[model samples]
Target: MDSELAAASQWATESNAAVFIRLKTESGVVQAMDSEEGDEEENEEGEGADVIEFHPEFTYPIYGEHERIFGYKGLSINLNYAAGSLATYFNIKYTKRIEQMESTSTVALKADDIDTPMRQILADSVCATQSEFAQQVVHDTRVFRPSGRKVHEYAGRSSQTEQLRYEIYSSSFNDTESAKYHERMQAFVLFFIEGAQFIDTSDERWHVYTVFERLDMNGQTSYSLVGFSTVYNFYCWPDRKRARISQFLVLPPFQGQGHGSALYSYIHAMVLGNSDYADLSVEDPSEAFDDMRDRNDMRYLLKHNAFAHIKGARVEQSAISELQHTHKLSRRQMTRCIEMALLKMIKSVKSQEFGEFRLFVKRRIYAQNMDLLQALDPDERKHKVAESFASVVDGYRRVLSLL
Candidate 1:
């Protein structure tokens, strides 16, 4: 077992490989040939012991790359454990051919063409699920003011009603020099909006697309359409499952209003109504169905009820290590790690009060939670931080939900 593992590790190091196991038995002639080697040579005074001739019965190869990689080693040990006399020898072969294929077949995400209206619609549709206001805007097309007047109108307004007319296109970011930049801007945006992450980004299991909204205001203008992505997980029982979402953003100025809701409505309609994308069915009925049904009812009410119900809750507790890791905090230790780091940086310049430092950390954490800056002392910085945080957190939250 140790020798086989060493060989596999060595092979993997040389070729970037994965391993599996295989089992086989020797043939009759081969077994006889092997047994003949064990016979004692003929002695001067005595005839050689009766020449024992035995051979293996049969042999078969296991299918699949996994078998070839790991099964070979497992078979070696299994054969060795077959007590009594030597039964069979499991052959292990190291192949560079398989490794090359694996390296070449890695799946990658590329930017979609953002030049068409349909693409924009798809992106926006995906994004809508993330932001309630964006959802509403996509659905209604007409944005309503606080007074219930159609004050802000999107493109494709015919007379008074807003029409949904968008297209999708394909683009590539491979030309981008920095892989991280392309991933952060393009791939991460999709994953973040979809509320998921890729354990292996090279795997071809993820599909990403972007939509660009077309505005025909005298001339023409295009806004970044919401991006959408889906992951194919075959491990789930029975059917292959995929989770998808629409528009994931509300432009800074266009936010606060009910555009997000409209976008979400459009996404719900798309997901539930369309067959080409994803299939939404309740799973684990006793657990998820009740809550899902309630949420669905609430959605219906929000659309119909004049007096809508809105609840706001704030939770403050010690951050767990997993939570910190998920949030991308540097320190593994939770208590005072972030706060202490901030204090050290502040004190490096001058003596800062503990209260002021605490406020700064609280604001930073709060901004992360709310997806917006709530600081008033530095209005410009506060606004910038808030907007940036909101944009990122919205995308993050959307993708997280999908996962």
Candidate 2:
């Protein structure tokens, strides 16, 4: 029994460099053999596995110039079909081939153009092609109840609106079932992101906080998990703890309703509020998350009167300290919040207030670009300064717009 199982596993684990696809039809399954080594018997099995062929070396210019990000080892695609119809689609073509493919109407289709005939050919098909190393976009995402920090009170300051509620889970290695759910939940990030990998939770450093909406119908409250965040606690010097946010995701349905801001506020109040927390960090935040971070941090600082003293020529270290001491923000976060607060004080881009704000940003940029000042010619230097000024002002404009 063990030997048979091992043989089946070995056969299923075989890797190929060509695309494997099966077409589900009313008659039976039909396989497409594009590779030299593809087998009918081997293809008949392992329907759930991924298989594909590869080019020796490939580059994706769409991602960036000569983007070798995926390592270009192999490509796997499943033209999924169910109920005798095409349910999902996959397309893979070399970057250089796209220009040629789109030019012909008979043999090629535009990027957005859907081919109905192609769908019929591969409907209800399974294709498996993957390399030696396994890839899992998501692990487990089922979050168990009463697992972490639950904020029950609504219509209060802790949340943006009393109608919404969230819980912050403190996950570790010992919580077996909850941890699996967390792994599965991490898979959801692939819906919005391209590259997402599972984290080994055996290490004790990870702290997972999941947010959910508390639904109450006829006084029967149920929790629907909405979003989750994973933070790694790193021990700093002097025995202080630095928490770096690894992943922060708020589901699409709950987004744009201030739930993200509310969750952030709760994290700050729960983690950074404590004396043990030295600072907070994020891991390669997306542009949208950065905007949300700026807005929420500024809102928190503004509410605490820390930003009140930094307006109208009041940019002082002591004033910054007041915010730092209250929020326990890292040096980088504090500086960004200060800049955002300074920009918020401005009424218009045409006014003197804007000039002061511009000067404030430019002065820092100038000091940082001293080496540039020494390198560029005088005419080029002016253009560089204007470019930097515009870039900084554009960021301020975004912050202000979000506010």
Best by lDDT: 2
lDDT per residue for candidate 2 within 1-403, as digits (tens), equals 5554443332221112223333222112222222325442223333322222122111121222232222122333233221111222344432222223322344432222123322332323323332100111011011124454454333423333334355455556567656655644543453344454456688888878776555333443435555777888889788778888888887654578777777777777766657788778788888888889888887777777776556563476676666676678876678777777777777677888777777766676777789968698888887888898887667767887866
lDDT of 1 by residue, 1-403 (tens): 4554444443322111221111111122223334456442211111122112111111111122222222121121111100111112222232222222223234331212112322221212222211232233233222211111111223433433233333332222332322222243332232123232223445444333333343333342223232222323232244434333322443222334434444443444444443343333222222222223333323443344311221111113433344333322223122233333333334333344544554554565555545334344467665665575455334333433432
For all candidates, the clash counts are 62, 20
Q: How far does residue 250 in candidate 1 sit from its true spot (Å)?
A: 3.7
Which candidate should be chosen as best, given TM-score against the real structure? 2
* Model 2, runs deviating above 4 Å: 1-146, 149-166, 194-196, 218-221, 311-322, 347-356, 366-382
The C-alpha RMSD of each candidate to the native structure, in angstroms, is 27.6, 14.2
TM-score of every candidate? 0.24, 0.58
